[model samples]
Target: MAIDLRDPDESYVSFWRERHMCTLTTIRPDGTPHVVAVGVTFDPEGGPKGIARVITNKHSRKVANVLAAGPEGARVAVCQVDAGRWATLEGRAVIRTEPEAVADAVARYADRYGRTPTPNPDRVVIEITLTRAMGRA
Candidate 1:
């Protein structure tokens, strides 16, 4: 079910904090979805609204898909599940290649996943400024 983005439930918020693999769905140039498993992290300091982030290789197809769409960004959805509970965050995503942005995403990923990812010089961050959230948390 769709949930209010502003008045998010504490349980729902906690669910996102839980460690779980999420599937990021990015649109292909032909309008097909290209979904892949990824470790996602949420940042609550972005603005009035927090954003979800996924760090990946700069040359990854997902990053390519987002770039192929347009400068505004590509529509994307990230979903996670565990047994009977599941949740999804959907929004427009853009590729962030700045060193600071990539480093910040890597740091957040480490904090959430317990270990820093293998250092990759080609790292890039897909920043999703959340527009909607839904789940049965």
Candidate 2:
């Protein structure tokens, strides 16, 4: 369903803010989905709409999938579930390698997951400019 990031449902926002393992789904070059467990952070105040970030190594397959999509970016979704509640953030994802971007992603991840991510020279961030949300949350 459609979602207004500027002022989303409190339940939805609350669920996303909680610490829960999430899954990131990216389309591979063969048009098949490549899903993997990941830690995701959501910032409703990030941009014009909002943004969800996933910090990962540049060599990760998920990163490769996004890169294969090229300039237009890859359509992606970040989802989490617990008990009977769930929520998903869907958007076009881009791989950001700038030091500043990676640092920011780590900070956000720490805030959500309660621990700083391990330092990695090859770190990169997958940024999703959220466009839709759905689930029972």
| TM-score per candidate, chains pooled | 0.95, 0.95
Relative to the unseen true structure, what is the C-alpha lDDT of residue 79 in candidate 2, on a scale of 0 to 100? 95
* lDDT leader: 2
Q: In candidate 2, what are the lDDT values of residues 63-96, reduced to their tens digit?
A: 9999999988999999999999988889999999
lDDT of 1 by residue, 1-137 (tens): 99777677889888888889999999999988899999998665465566999999999999999999899999999999999999998888999999999999999898888999898999999999988888999
Name the weakest run of 10 consecutive residues (lDDT summed) in model 1.
Answer: 41-50
User: Which segments of model 2 are wrong by more than 4 Å?
Assistant: none
